[model samples]
Target chain A: MRIWDPSIETLDRVSLRQLQLTRLRETIDRAYHHVPCYRSKFDELGLGPGDFRNLEDLRRFPFTTKEDLRLNYPYGMFAVPMKEVVRIHSSSGTTGKPTVVGYTKKDLESWAQLVSRFMTAAGVTDEDIVHIAFGYGLFTGAFGLHYGAERIGASVIPMSSGNTDKQIMIMQDYRSSALVCTPSYALTIADRMEKTGIDPATLALKVGLFGAEPWSEEMRRELETRLGIVATDNYGLSEIMGPGVAGDCLERCGMHIAEDHFIAEIIDPETLESLPFGEWGELVLTTISKEALPMIRYRTRDITRLHPEPCRCGRTHVRMEKTRGRSDDMLIIKGVNVFPTQVEEILFQAEGCEPHYQLIVDRQDNVDSLTVEVEVNDQIFFDEMKLQRIFIQQLEKKLATGLGVGVRVKLVEPSSIPRFEGKATRVIDRRSR
Target chain B: MKVEQISIFIENKSGRLAEVSRVLGEAKVNIRALSLADTSDFGILRLIVDRTDEARKVLQAHNFTVNKTEVVAVEVPDRPAGLAEILQILDDVQINVEYMYAFVERCSGNAVIIFRFDNVDEAIAALLGRGVNVLKGEQVYEL
Candidate 1:
């Protein structure tokens, strides 16, 4: 019922900008001096850390992209030495190399504090038992929420992901108070609970924090009803400190960004210039307070607008619209992000598959399903039915493993799918909004 | 001998079949026999036409996916077991039929069954060796 850091969270725009200015100056200096990539980019533009004057100066610098992070690979973007770095996390990439993120000990502390602020804002109390169901290991979602809940003196349940029946059992036995994971997985747990005929009112869950992929308001309504809890969407990306970058504050309005640490801007994706507030455009973030791997003007490719108006909750941070669509070809299926080009890369490299393929995405029974219809060469088409079935199954397995989501592949004869005259229509999303 | 058949992939829409008919009619292509294999999303319009090359070209020019497949054209008498005997011979020989369609010419008592086999060469050889009459490409097209 209390804001974690009231002084910083509710700071007026004048002081917040003053604080951000100091942090941005330090971040820019750290990046230019330590990270070779940042240094070279600045050198190419004939700019330096000293050139940064005010918030508007961010537009003058070139944008950092996912490709740049990948090009740097494991640690090229880190501004601190490995000895000072405490942790590393990565996101799945279309190409073989992934986008790696590093955190110094101070960076970790700040990240945990930011995450704690959002959790508290979402109405999770210290006395509550928080159950973190996001996947562990390489992904940042699970660990970020885990440490934040622990930081706030809440008892944490590190029940990674999967094992639905056991998840339901823990919810009953442990009397978990707050549920944390992707919205889709929360729905999956609700679905399993329904099959087992367990009434959600019998559980102790009161609040849910969901993120890591785009979800719908309708999904929020269903999750709230199914779990008997107030479900709030949290927005974040691995490029910018994971799930605590911004989150809703029990208002069920737009998610409030941790603006003191991360300055956000909405830009026209084509023009790459800042759009007027409240107009939908691609989201770009500049991490002012991040130290180890400080990212300046990182293009997130997520489409949402900023709402700087005063919120009913009294928080001064800007609220971003819940992102339901992205500016890129990224598709969020069952909480996993997939790109059509990624599917193209996998299918094009696999044998017996023609480069021609179409991605059909639909939601059935409240779960997102991806159906990839691919064209097969003449040799496979004429093969026995059993052989064709086997091939399709194998292709489905390969794609599912690559995409980190279940895939259903249907084989069509060569040239059966329509060819577009210009820009090929590779994806058809039939999922009703 | 082998007979060439034109197969066009059609979306399962209301006017798709009519569109195909109009395209072939405009090209002056005579349809000897026709059948449809369909699924929920799409269908394959299989046609044995008087001009196989012209039909395939016209459909392809109209942006339709068209393919030429070789099938066997056999004479089945109008008697009850006439079609059964031909299928029985193939069943006995283990020649799996992928798909088949039939049509009769000019109110003739004999029907020509078009059979698509997995092993087309072996099936043709076995049918010919058994004294079954199989029409050549020209004979079927000229009929």
Candidate 2:
């Protein structure tokens, strides 16, 4: 059995707030003194550290955005100098430039402890051999989990993404007791496992910590059924010091936020005013213990709610619902909110088509139209005219049912569409504003 | 004897045939003979083009995935019993003709029928041994 540090991880509501205030004050002072950007923001706001007495006063601090990080560029936001920085990670800059993050030696240790706490929350122990499939690189996911598993004395198989055959081979050979990867990749592995005649339950996997993308309860149920393991959501970002900010406990309710190292707040995205608990709003995070970069009220842009209710796992860390969608990435098609992942689910369930797809959104006659181009697998073939008509009709109907919006379906030949090994870009918004 | 052919996978949809044809037309590739084999969801568009290599290259360059397949083309007289005689020979040899489509014969008063079989070589041998005129790759391309 895994043990949790209740004193730090499960501080009561009052103590948690007090600890947050102290940390916030110290963090704010450090940022103002070290980071020129934070200093300028404070000067512009005409505020000082004394103004922020508690978590409620966090709003006084100026919000930090991805653009702000880009403005500062590499290492400009560092509270400590370059000599102290130990590790660096970055987000995939699919749209623009990548956001780089840095950490010190103590920061890495703290990150590991937080990740370990997340694993323990999911019932992972030293006996569990964790098969980590998250891609390794400047990306924080692989190393964060690797360090956390090491911290817990668990045997970790660093199986970075792809080579599905090898991943399955090692899983069976090593009898890995746990898995860490994005939920989508987990399903891919599950599908491959089924095809290879290996029962997921028979594998040594007992739990899966899936994150780095927003997924639904329906998806969670599907993953649980396919892998025959308890699937828990782990939430973190490179901006917030990687995976370990929070995770789902054994009860599998909401992910418990690590209130000790980070302070989380729900704010109305439009007004930037704090919202009451349980209200759907934008999530904001502040790194309290970070050395290299101690961000204050960094706007994560992830829409979710926070639940302070005590978890059955006995951890007092406040929990947050799975992120609904990025405020910037959410698509409004035909007056309905459509997520790329939603379209992905429908495509996954569609018959005789590869998962490779692209969604082209165009506007003509002031009406938004969606064109979903899916790659047809080579194994399936049809008589020409009849096949074309039937495929188009079936896909349109399925899209209507799945997304509640009618869409034009284009069936293209396999390998005709672009494939991404990292973050898949499925949406193309071409509507003229 | 030679023949040029283009094999393409197409999903059943309105304007799909027109789109493929338009693409070929835009590329200045002429289709000599064409046939379609389809299922409930999708179809394969097979064509013998005026310039097989050019057509294949143009289609592939435009991101249309296509395949080159060997198909046996037999010259038969443009008479009521022309196809029946060939079918009888194939049936006797237990050669399953997966699909067959008619192509205009360059020689007057005769029609060329393209036969896609489970085993192309065996089908070609059966047709040739039965005194049927089987076109080679060069001959079909020339036609």
Q: Which candidate leads the pack in lDDT?
A: 1
Candidate 1 global TM-score:
0.79
Question: What's the lDDT of the predicted structure labeled candidate 2?
Answer: 0.81
Tens-digit lDDT string for candidate 2 (A114-227): 999999988899899999998787778899999999999899999997788899999999999999987767877887888889988778999999887667898789888888
CAPRI rating of model 2: incorrect
Per-residue lDDT for A35-78 in model 1, tens only? 99999999999989888778788788888988888788889898
List the global CA lDDT of all models.
Answer: 0.85, 0.81
Per-residue lDDT of A289 in model 1: 84
Candidate 1: TM of chain A?
0.95
